[model samples]
Target: MSTTTAPPQPALPIRGFAEFLGTALLVIAGVGTAVAAPDTGTLGIAMAFGLALLVLAYTLGPVSGCHVNPAVTLGLLVARRIEPAAAGVYVVAQLLGGLAGAGVVLAFRSGDPSFDLSADGLGANGWGAASTGGYGLSSAIVVELVLTALLVLVVLSATARQSNAAVAGLPIGFTLVVAHLVAIPVDGTSVNPARSFGPAVLTGGTALEQLWVFIVVPLVGGVLGALVYRVLRGSDSDAASQDTPDPTTRAGS
Candidate 1:
């Protein structure tokens, strides 16, 4: 008997689109919830982000590993799980996707006669008075760094080859929920730079001024998380090779 093999896939573009769409959906669902329902509180916002990620992980994970976040991409890059060029492309896609999602939210808000992008803010992250709990700059930096680092660590572990791919989404999503729950009051919880960038670009003023904190801290945290993972699991390449599978393959197959 003879068996047919599947054709090779165009790895980059498909993966890139998956990242783009996944990230856009994440912002739309997560930030959209916050904009539409300001009274949802921390748990509601956390659940919004978590559920969005969980669904995206299962839906797009097969195509792009559903990174949807630059910090996560950077974490994989530092771990050597992805090549530099691919990681760059993923980051670009994620940023553009975030912008697109925020634009959609902006459009929706325009429907309201009282909506003000600058004053209302599109769920942009910040410190001090902008922070939900008025946490200071140092507090914001430390909280984002630690939470983002932990989030990336969860991503690295959940997607490892030794992990059960079938169930990775649950833990990864739950970790995001926990991160938001802990850091929402501090700096609105930006473990993802793209997520922070979208609203800042739209809101301007202080959000734009404080944007650096979200971007730099999350990136640093991502690298730290990858390094910590390397320490715990040994060489990244070896572990990644042992568990990582071809992107063309169906997830959980």
Candidate 2:
């Protein structure tokens, strides 16, 4: 019997769309929750972000590795797991997706008579006056850098082995939850640049002005996280040598 092999699917556009949709859903759940229900408090908002990503990971992981966050995409890129061109596409898609999701939230929110864009910030991230806990610039920087690194590290490590693929989303999603739990009161937990960009662009003012912090710091954090992953994972040759086993050992010893 002869079997015919199927042609490989085009990766860029399809994967990019998956990333777009996944990121959009993430913003819709996380930012939307923050905007719609400020009363639910920090844990509710954190869970919103985490649960959305958990579902998106399983839904879009096969298509695009479900890197809905640009920081996560950058971590994969630094690890050399993704080509530069593909990574660019993924980032662009994610930014546009975030904007789209925020637009959706704004559209419905505007209908509310009491919703004032200026008075009620649309879940944009920042420090100082914009911060929920009145955190300073330095505090914002450290929180973003550290928590983003932690988030990127979890994403990198959990997805390292194919055997772990079945549940990689668990740790990744949980890490985001923990990051938010810690940073929500500090600077609204912008481990995700795109997530911050969406609401900031629409809401304007401080969130928009301070957008650079959310963007630049998280990217640096991603690179740092990737490099740490490299150290802990060791070289590919080292992994291979370890897998070869020691022939000098007696069989069934």
Candidate 3:
């Protein structure tokens, strides 16, 4: 008798590259909007992020789920939708994309006579004296955590059931708008680690010093949201049932 082993699956480099490109687009479009239009006001900035998400979700949602945020990746990992290895890769790609996006913004700013990287900080997130709304770090943390939690919840619900698939992009984008509406004043709405990392790298100093809060809070909230979603869907024990398409799939479609 001869023994044979299954061949390893080929790497999906396209997926990884797609993730990188998609996240870059997200951060560039979003952060760029903030910097270019600092006078655009809160609602305008919110729209920038919301519109970026709406476009990216539709364009990359099918390809790589269009996470664009490390918290979202962690959320899916906690939900067991993605393996640890894959999640790691996704996060790395997202970070690279973020840096690239911020780099693009910096390049553009270089041409402007009044552009001061240190003074502007490229829209970095912060709290208290550094905060746009003068909210304390503690308040900023709470706002980021809760907003990320709610954002993840919307992502989970929209992507899980097939019925809502049609409007999934709409809700996902809108949820971001809502999150920004609340948390922008608190911490510039850094529910996305990649988004935070870019401007910090460019801005440095206090922005870099306070980077950890953005990373920690959103991840914690993501894990909590995933756990809540799993519990509600009864996926802890009934793995088979959990894998089944949600009944509302058709209805939502």
The per-model lDDT (C-alpha) reads 0.82, 0.79, 0.75
For candidate 1, report its TM-score: 0.92
Q: Tens-digit lDDT track for model 1 on 1-253?
A: 1133323445799888988898888999889988888799999999999999989888987787788989888888888777799889989999999999998988898899998776888999999889889889999899888988898888777777634577888888999999989988988888999999898898899999999999999999999998898888886545464456633221110
* Superposition-based RMSD of candidate 2 using all C-alpha atoms, in angstroms: 7.9
Alpha-carbon shift of residue 201 in model 2 (angstroms): 0.8
| Candidate number with the higher lDDT (2 or 3) | 2
TM-score of 3: 0.88
C-alpha positional error of residue 91 in candidate 2 after TM-score superposition, expressed in Å: 0.5
lDDT score, candidate 3, position 31: 85
Candidate 2, residues 106-125, lDDT tens digits: the string is 98888999999999978899
Colliding residue pairs in candidate 2: none
Winning model by lDDT: 1
Off by over 4 Å in 3: 1-11, 236-253
Best by TM-score: 1
- In terms of lDDT, model 3 sits at 0.75
Candidate 2 lDDT (Cα, 0 to 1) = 0.79
